[model samples]
Target chain A: MGEESKKELTLSVSAPSGTSKEDHASRRTFIKNLAIAGAVIGTNALVAKKVASVVLEKDPQRAYLEDVLPGDRVMMAREYVVMTDEEKKRLVKTLIENYKKRLG
Target chain B: MKREDKKTTIEKNIEGSTRRDFLKKTGSLSVAGLAGVATLMTGTKDAQARVTWAEWFQTNYRLMTEEEKREAIERLEKRYSEEYGKKVTVDGRPAQKNVLFGYALNIQKCIGCRRCVKACVKENNQSRHDPEIEWIRVIRMEKGKFSAEDMDKGYPSDYGIQVGGNAYKNAGVVLEGQHYYQPERVPEKDAFYFPIQCMQCEKPPCVKVCPVRTTYREPDGIVVIDYNWCIGCRMCMGACPYWARRFNWGEPNLPKEEMNPDTHYLGNRPRMKGVVEKCTFCLQRTRKGRYTACVEVCPVGARKFGNLLDPESEVRRILERKRVFRLRVDLNTFPKFFYFID
Candidate 1:
C-alpha cells in the first residue's frame, strides 16, 4: 500500500504539463495558507456567535429573594425536595390521629 | 540443503506470510495499543474523556499516599470545575490532633423551622431536584402528656381498653413524629421540633456493615464516606439507627450556579450516583475551626458544636450544665451528638 501511494504521488507530480517543481510547491503552500485562514475565520465566527448568545441572553428572568412569597420560598427549598402543603397537612393529621388513638 | 538456503526455503514455503511481516504487524499493533492507553492515561478533551478512566482505578482515600492523595484531589478539582462551570476546591484536610468534635441540640428550643435543613443542603451541595438530598431532617412531635382532668374518657374506637382521655382529646399520648410536617409557620402551640443528623458515633454501626469499608469514623468522631469507593450496597444505610444515611437514588442534579464551590473530600463535596451519603458534621467547615452550616444557621441558637476534648467548648459546657442525653444509648454506638433540654 505504501509503495502504490508513493507511485501515484510520483505520477501526479510528473504529469502536470508546464508546471515546474517550484510552481507545484508554491501552489501547495497557497492551499495550505488558504485552509489555515478559513479555519481561523470559521473558529472566530463560532466564538462570536457563542459570545453574542451569552451577551444577549434570552434566559427567563429569575425572581429576587424578597419578591418571592414566603410560602413559595418554603416550598422551593433552594432546590431541595419538599412535600406540598396538602401532603404535609395530611401527614400531620394522620400523626395527630395516631396519637389520639394511642391516648384512647 | 545449506542452513541459509533452508531458512529461505522455509520462509518461501509459508503461504501468504513472512517473518518480517509478522514482526512488523505485531509490533505496530503493540505500539498502537500502547498509544491508545497513553491517550487515555494522559487524558483528552475528546468526548470530554477526562479523569473518569483513571478515577475508576484509584485506591481508597485511606490507602492513598500523600502524593496520590494530592493528585486525586487535583483531578477531582479539575473535573468539578469543568463540570460546574466554576472553580471548585476539593479539600483533603485530615482530622486535627486532640480535637474530638461534639454537637448538641436544644430540642426544646428548635422551632421546627427547618432552616438548618435548607442551609445544610445549600452548603453541602446536595442533589437539588429529582433525588433531593438534605442531611438534616426536622421531625415535629406533638406535645402530649397525662392530665389529671381526664380520668373517665373512653377510647375513640370501641375495641381497645380506655386509658385516660379528655372530653374532646386524648391524654398521655405522643405521636411517633412527622418528617413531612410543614406549617404556615413553625413553633406551633402543640408541637416541638427534633432535628436528626449523623451523630458521628464513636463506634458507627454503618462502618461495621459497610461491605466496601468506604464509610468510617474519623479521629475527630466525624463519620465520613469515600463516595468513590462505595459499592452502593446500602448495608450501612440499614445498619444506621439514626436513619441518617441517604442514597443517591438517581443521578444527582446539582445546578452549576447553586453548586457550593468550597468542598471537602469526605464531607460536603458533590457526590456521584449510587453512593450513600450522610451528614459528616460539616467537617469541611468544622475542621477549619468554623461551625457546621446547621449550627451557624439555626435561628433559635438550638444547635451547638465544639471540641469535646476542650472543657471550655460550648458542647462540653452543654454536656456539663444542661440536661443532655445521647439518642439510642442502648445501641452502644456512643454518638458524639447530644440532645439537651433546657
Candidate 2:
C-alpha cells in the first residue's frame, strides 16, 4: 500500500507532456528548498520571540520603557541641580536680552 | 437528557432533601468558600491577590482614621517595595498648622530652560512614557507688536469678533503661545517664557466640578486629590482654567529604577489608571519643611515657594515687594500661585 501511494505521489509530480525532465527536476528541487527555508525562518522567529519574553520577564519595566520616544525620555537628560553662580549669571543675561528686545 | 426526565430528577432531589440536610450542605459550602478566600488572602505575596483587594475597599485618604491610614500606608509600602525592588515609603503627613503654602514664579527671570518641568516629572513620579506627564508647562510667547495698522484693523474696520489684535499685528503678548519649541539654547531671541501649574486655588474650579468630592483644599491651603476615590470623570480637567489637571488615560508607565521611593500619598505616589492627578505643591516634602522640586531645580531662582502666612517667607516677600499678579484674576479662582517680575 505504501509503495502504491508513493507511485501516486510520483505520478502527481510528473511534468506535463511538453515539459522537459531537467526543468521538472529543477522545479521539484526549488519547491522543496522553498519549504525548508520557510520552516527555518518560522522557527527562528519563534525562538527570537521566546528570548525577548525571557528578557522582558527578567526586567518587566524594560517592555514599558521600550516604547518611549527618545525626546520624551527625561531620565536620559542631565538631571537639574541647584544653579551655580556662573549658570545663574548666564541665564540672567539671556533673560535681559529677551526682555530688552520686547521692551524696544 | 429529555426535558421530562430532567424535571423529574430535579423534583426528586428537591423533595428528598430534608431541612437539616439542606442547611448542612449550604453551611459546608460556605465554609469551603471562606477557606478558599482566606487562603488566597494569606497564602500569596502577590500584590493583586492581597494589597489591591484591600486598596479597592479602603476609605479616602481624607476620611481614613489614623490607624486606618497607617495600615493603608503600610500596605502601599509593602506592595511598592516588592514591585520596585527597594524600600518605598508613602508619606501620610498631615498639613502643618498655620502654614498656608504659596508659590511665586519670576516670569522675567525664567529662561525657558524647562529644568523645572523635568524636575517636577522626576520628583512627582509622573508617568515616564506613552503619556509623558509633567505638571509644569512652559509657554514661549513672541513679543507682540503694537503697530498703528493693527490698531485700526481690529476695531469696526473689520467685520470679525472685534478682539483686540488684528490680522496685521498683536497689541501685547498675544494669546498665541508655542508650547513645544525646541531651541539650541533657551531665552531664544525675542521670546519670553510663562510657566504654569496648579494654582492651589482658594476656590479651585477643579474641586467644585469633581462629582466624587475626591479633590479638596487641605487646611494648609494645598489642593489635593484622593486618587483612589477619583472616578476619572475628567470634569476637573475641563473646569480648571490653568489646564492643571491630568487624567491617567492608561495605566501609568512608571519604571522601577526611575521611581522616586519617597512619595506623599496625595502628591507623587505612583498612580494607577482611571485617576486624576495634579500638582499638590509637593505636600510630601512641603509638609516636612522642604521646597517643592520645581523651586529647588529652577536655574535662575525663578521659582519660589513658602508658607504664605509667614511675613519672612519668600512667597510673601515677593507679594509685598515685586510686581506680582495671579493669572485669570477676573475668573475669581483666587489662586495661591502668583507670577512676579524682579
Candidate 3:
C-alpha cells in the first residue's frame, strides 16, 4: 500500500471499535496538538499545569489564594510568565474579564 | 608560518598588502565602526543613567555614615531623575527621636472601599501598569468566627469559611475570609473587612528573618526596608505573618508622570526589580509628621495614625478606649496596627 493508505490503516486500527471516520480524524488532530503543546513548553509539567491554571482561571486573584476561592480573585500583572500562543489567547480573555470587574 | 609572524610580515610589506588582506582589514574595520555607531545611537542620554560601583556597593541605611548617605542620596536622585526624565528628590529623612508610629482601624467603619489601597500605590512608588503590586490586602470575612488560630487549622475555616455552611445558601455560593474580596459595594451585608499591611510590628518577624538585614525596624518603631541592599531572597516575605511584603518577579514599570517625585531613602524611593517592598507607614510622609496616605485618604475616618509615644495622641487614646485587637496576637508580634470597634 502507498504511504497515505498505510497511515489510514494505522489510524483505523488505533481507533476504538465502531468509531466513525470523523471521530478518528478528530482524535488524530487532538493528539497531534497535544504533542506540539508538550514540545513547545520550556518548563516542567508542574509549572505548565500552573501556567494552564493561570490561563483558564482568574479569580480570587493569585495562585497562592489560600483565602480567596479558586474563581473570585483577579489576576495580578506581576504573575505573568512566558506562554504559548494558545495560552496567551486565554490569558488575554481572562485579563479583559478581570479588567471589567476592576479587581484591586 | 606562525600566524603572528605572517601578520607582522604583511604589516611591514613595503609593496602594500594583497586584495585578500585589504578586504579582511576593511571588513573588520567597518564592523567595528558599525558597532561604535550603534552604541552611540542607542545610548541613554543621561550620562549617570547607569548604576555606579559606589551606588552598587553603598553601605546599608543603618550603617551609612552622614557623608556616605549624602553621596548615596545624590546618586539615587540623579539616576532616578534620568530614568524618569524629571527632577526627583531622594531624601534620607530620619525618624524623630520623640516619635513612635502607631496605626488603628475602626473595622466597622471601613466600608472595604479599598481607597487606601489606591492611595498607597500612588504615594509609595509601588509598581504599576505591569505586574501590579499592592502593599495592603483587605480580607473580607463572613460574620463568623475567624482568627490566626483558625487559619492554622487549614481549609475553608482557615480562610474563614465555616464548614457545613448555611444549608439554604446556594451551592458554590459560600465565599469568605479570602485576601482578595471584590464585592460590588464593600461592607456586604453579612460580611466585614480586614485591611492588612505591614503592621510596623514592634518585634517584626519579617525583620528577624532577613539574612541580609535589609529590613529593620526604625528607632521610631516603623519597620522599613533598604531596597538597594535587599538580595531578593524572599526570606522576609516568608516570615511576615501578615503577608505584607511583595516581590518583583519581573522588571516593574512605572510611568514618568506617575512616579512619585518625593521619596525617602528607606521608604517610597523607586525600587528596582527583585527587591522586597512593604508599607513603611509612607516613610516619605510619615517621618515628616504627616499621616500615611491610607489614613489621609480614608473618607470614613476609619483609619487613624499617630505617635504611640504621645499620651494624648489619637492612637494612644484609641488603645486606651476602644475594644481593639491585633491579628495573630498570640504570636506576640506586638504589631502597631490594630483593628478596633467603637
Model 3: residues with Cα > 4 Å off, grouped in runs? A1-104, B1-50, B145-180
User: Model 3, range B205-290, lDDT digits (tens) per residue?
Assistant: 99889999989977777788898889999888768766777777555778889999999998888887678888889878987778
Q: State the C-alpha lDDT per candidate.
A: 0.73, 0.73, 0.71
TM-score of chain A of each: 0.38, 0.39, 0.23
Task: After superposing candidate 2 on the true structure, give the runs of residues whose Cα lies further than 4 Å from its correct spot.
Answer: A1-104, B1-45, B145-177
Q: Stretches of candidate 1 above 4 Å error?
A: A1-104, B1-48, B151-177
State the lDDT of candidate 1 residue by residue for B153-222, as single tens digits: 6555566655446544432122342555768888888776767788888778999998878998777778
Model 2 chain B worst lDDT window (10 residues): B168-177
TM-score of chain B of each: 0.82, 0.82, 0.78
Model 2 lDDT tens row, B1-342? 255456545644654453346457657867976887677555266765568778878987878899999999899888988888899999988888667788888878999999988989999999987577778777776554556665665455366566666655431252232555688998887777878788998778988988988999887778899887888888887688777777675678999899999997888999987687888998888899898999998889999998776668888677666776666666777677877776
- iRMS for model 3? 23.6
Best-to-worst lDDT order: 2, 1, 3
lDDT of 3 by residue, A1-104 (tens): 69889778755654543344345446556755765686466347768788886787543224223322322333120121223445334423443343334323
Better of 2 and 3 by lDDT: 2
All predictions: root-mean-square deviation over Cα? 16.7, 19.4, 21.1
